[model samples]
Target chain A: MTGYLNIILRLTIWFLLTADLSWANIVIGVGVTILLPRGVTNVGLLKDWLRTLGEVAVAIPQAYKEAFEIMLYPHREETVVLERVKPRRTPSLIFLDIFLITFTPKTIVQRYHSRGWYEVHYIQRRETP
Target chain B: MINILSYTCIILGLVFWYWGTWPLLGRRSVLYKLHGLSVADTLGSMAIVVGLLLRIPHEWPLLVLALISLSIWNTVLGYVLAYCVTDDGTHDVGQEVGHGG
Candidate 1:
């Protein structure tokens, strides 16, 4: 499933870049996607993938809100907290998790400990009640 | 209506860009500055691309691609920067300072 998704993602990028729908273009896109080297394949659950997607969608609005909060409160308190990674997450999902955490303004994953912990840097308004 | 909306988005994106970037001038930890930079750079740029898409519907594919890549690349870059900087013994220093302040 991940492999198919990878192919589709590459094909979408190729189509967008070329802005072409010709048979030749489609053939070349497919050829390139096939030729591209993929790393170790980890079979991740589709349920996990969908949940990550939902988090991504939710993060957009939350990001905007966080941005506003950061802007309003320039003076912030910073701290590093150890966060646990969800059990059985594939590499792609782990990558997505890190991305989602860092995408927001309030927190960033500083380091990923091999023992399923993320050293997350968090920021918040100093005057928060 | 669309024109106004697109302009608003573009302007809003610019505001976010500044909001996120202005913190770099502060005397804060690297991670703090990175948080602001990543949020602004990625989200602001995405907003600008979204506005462009609204203005030029004909170029939806390219603009959409831009949005996707911008978010993914910026987020990854932020994580990489944070990871690299904190890997050394500097993390202890940062922790101490954070607690002190």
Candidate 2:
């Protein structure tokens, strides 16, 4: 199922790039997508996948909000903190987690330790009081 | 109505671009600057693409693909950059301390 989805995604990009729908184009798109090397499939839980997608959706709005906040208050303090990664997460899920974290303006993943900890760099508005 | 909205989006994206890039001139750490750059560049570029899409509905497929790639590629590139810089900084600090002692 995932393999088919991957092929479909690649073909979609191919068609978009070429902006064509002829039979010849379809055949060529399929050939290219199939010939591409596939990554190791780490079968992650469906629930986790849904959660990651939800996070991605949420990140868009959150990103806007954070951008506004940063623009409003430019004074900030920076710190490095270690965050624990959920156990048994697939590599793709982990990549999604990192992406979601870094998508916002105030935090970024600096490193992923082998022991399930992410070295996260954070920014916070400094109070003027 | 669509013309006004697209123009608004394009202007908003330009503002984001400026806001994000302005930090590079400040004395903040590299990571802080990167956070601003990545967030602004990705969101701003997406907004601009969306504006173009609204103006030219016939190019929906290409604009949508641009949006997808912008979000994913920018985020991953930011991560890779942050990782590389910090990794190198730590190694350099270690070497500096070794030489100092």
Candidate 3:
């Protein structure tokens, strides 16, 4: 029941965002919602997903803040640092991490190293000499 | 009042777009350039869409879709590009880990 409700809510939001009331759009939206791949489903633990979502929400605002800071203050040059992250669980979580971080202009995923580390490019303000 | 905010957002978005581009011309590494370009581009595009959303409230549905696509599709494209460009043919982690499945 909850899953169905979730699907309905997502479809409604999709329709509202698209602002299309046409039957074709509605049918397509419903089909896409229902046909979402099973691997893309929640990663087994609701709590972990919620925690990750909260982290992403927080990161978003911070990213915006960083974007403005970088643009407004060009004197402070930004440097890209490669950081390694190892997620014990599924690789999907790593993708989520990459997606959330990349959403902001502050950090992005550069590469996934075979050594179980993600090469993350972090934009940092360089310290004055 | 709303108009003022919308214009401000659009201008800010442009600033971000420029910010992203500036790094590209600099001496940064390719990964850094990619990072700067993608992040700034995505944020700026989203901000522009938001400004449009405010200006044309009637067309919000389309604007929101644009916003969603900008975020999702853009990120995915960036990931693919980064993966392809940075892949040294030595690392098989992506194939081994299997993303999006």
DockQ of each: 0.47, 0.34, 0.30
**Candidate 2 CAPRI grade:** acceptable
Task: List the global CA lDDT of all models.
Answer: 0.82, 0.80, 0.67
Better of 2 and 3 by TM-score: 2
Per-residue lDDT of model 3, residues A1-129, tens digit only: 124324744796779777777999989998888777543343435566577768877976787887777666553333333455644544566677778767766556666666666655444566423
Q: What are the per-model numbers of colliding residue pairs?
A: 0, 0, 1
**What's the lDDT of the predicted structure labeled candidate 3?**
0.67
Best by the lDDT measure? 1
Ranking by lDDT: 1, 2, 3
Which ten residues in a row are the worst by lDDT in model 1 chain B? Answer: B92-101
Docking class of 1: acceptable
Q: Summarize candidate 2's per-residue lDDT along B1-101 as a digit string, tens digits.
A: 99999999999899999989988998877888897897579988888999999999998888888998898889888889889888633622112111100
What would the C-alpha RMSD of candidate 2 be, to one decimal place?
Answer: 5.7
Per-residue lDDT of A90-110 in model 2, one digit per residue for the tens? 786787899899888787888
Which residue pairs come into collision in candidate 3? A17-B61
Higher-TM-score candidate of 1 and 2: 1
For lDDT, candidate 2 versus 3, the one ahead is 2
